[model samples]
Target: MKKFAVIALTEGGAQTARCLQEQLATQGFKVEVILPQRLAREREIYYRKGDFNSTMHRLFREYNCVVCIMATGIVVRALTGVVVDKTVDPAVIVMDEKARHVISMLSGHVGGANEWTRLIARLMEAEPVITTATDTEKVQALDVLTKKVNGWYPNFKENTKKINRRLAEGKAVELFIEPYLEKYVEQFNGFTLIRDIESHRGGTPLVIVSDHTGFAKNADIIHVVPQLNVLGVGCRKDVPIAMMQTAFTEFCQQHQLLWQSIVKVASIDVKKHEAAIQYLAKTLNADLEFYTAKELQKVSQKYPESAFVLKTVGVGNVACAAADYASGEQNVTQRYANHEITMALSRLHEI
Candidate 1:
């Protein structure tokens, strides 16, 4: 569920925050209200006047979205010390005590401030203010689109601005996406689809959606890496994290896969608490899934089997079986094995 923090500096603003809290709660959002000590009521967090900046920083760190029911200048000043890059910052929305206007103050696209601004404006019957160049010009923001598609920009800080600026100026940007993601073509507005990046001429902004790294050498090209690969691992008891990391890195290099494309790590249910497996999942920033031996045994018959593995884990293959089961397919795309670890790779066509 989405978490929201509503901050109010005065009694009237506290009332507004309470109303928003109720409405947002009914819509399945977790909302908390922060008010000044003099204005805070029951069930509200209170802070002193001198702690405004510190409080704002704390809220930004704790909440997914922050609604400041106060002057825009005050909100801006308090946030200047806490705000980070657009990719990691929380959405910040500012509104007057009277609820006349709801402005998307920071992280407009990647952090979903514009989306929250529209929702809050509709709830309070206020004017929504969004000033992002792409939004103002009615053009699609690549950063926002990437988030929606479960993708990340490899060159976010530099190439995103270059491409978004060209889009805001009403210029056509060329897009070359992997065939597996062709179903999402409708989302790419104001972009020309090119069959091959190799055939494209220079000068037009280009965006490539693929899992392969180093597909393009141009500094201007933006690479949107989709989360489409799953890694399955099985290791001996008490394996070192360094060995796991080395194996994972080598596997990615051998397969020509980007680490960002790995969406999940799968392992046998018995190894769910294994530190090496957990470390691998955390390092890849992917979800972890554990399958039972019975579930894996059903698919393990097709792959190569080891007698020692069967005696130890009740299944001939752990990595390939778990990967195939988690991917909802019977085929394992790649497989690797060492003395202490076994690994498998699977590609997911749909997110």
Candidate 2:
């Protein structure tokens, strides 16, 4: 659930915040209202009159969304010191004490301020004030598009600005996405899809969606890497973390895969507590899945199996079997092994 912090200054604002909280709760949002000590009711956080700036700074870092029921000037001044790039900042919305209008103050697209503004407006029956050019023009922002497709930009700050600027101006934007990613973005409009990346001329703004490396070498191309690869690993009982990291890095380099494209790490259930596997998953910032030997055994026949592994772990294969089962697809690569680690790669059916 998304956590929301509602900041109210006066008695009227406090009443509006409570009503908004109750409405948002019906929609399954976890809402907390903050008020001054004199106006605070039960279950609300109260602060000293002079501590509003500090309270805003703390809530900005802690919550997914912050709704300030006060003057827009107060919110803009208070958040000036705490504001960061849209990628890391929380969605910010501002409303008057009477709730006449709810404004999407900052981080409208990537941080979801625009969506929240519309929801709050609907629940409160207030007018939503959104000034983002993409929303006004009914064009899809590149950042929002990547987010919807479960992708990440390799160069987010610079590339996003250029592509979104073209979109806001109603210029043509070309998308060169791999076939696997076509299904996810087929519903979105406002972009021409290029079937082949090599046929594109250099002058037009282009966005490429792929998991391959070296596609972002050109400065003009915006590359969104899809998180679709699943890695299955088997390691020695106590392999060093550094060695495991090095082995995984070299494996990706050898396979021409981008490490950022890996979405999950899979292993046998018995090795769930292994330090090296944990380190690899944490380093990749990917989901970790552990399958029981019985589950893995069902898919072990598809790959070459080791008699020693079957005797030790009750499964003929660990890496390939676990990856194939977890991904619900055949292993993309044959089993790769070094001195202490064995690994296999598979692709998720969707992003």
**CA lDDT, every prediction?**
0.85, 0.88
For candidate 1, write residues 83-135 as lDDT tens digits. 87888999999989888999999899888999889999898899999999998
Task: For residues 210-250, write the lDDT of model 2, one tens digit per residue.
Answer: 88776646766778888878899998798889889888888
- Which candidate number maximizes TM-score? 2
Model 2 worst lDDT run, 10 consecutive residues: 181-190
TM-score versus the correct structure, for each prediction: 0.79, 0.80
- In lDDT terms, how accurate is model 2? 0.88
Off by over 4 Å in 2: 26-28, 97-100, 182-187, 214-216, 239-255, 272-279, 282-311, 314-317, 320-341, 345-351
Per-residue error at 25 for model 1, in Å? 2.7
Give the Å error, residue 292, model 2: 6.1
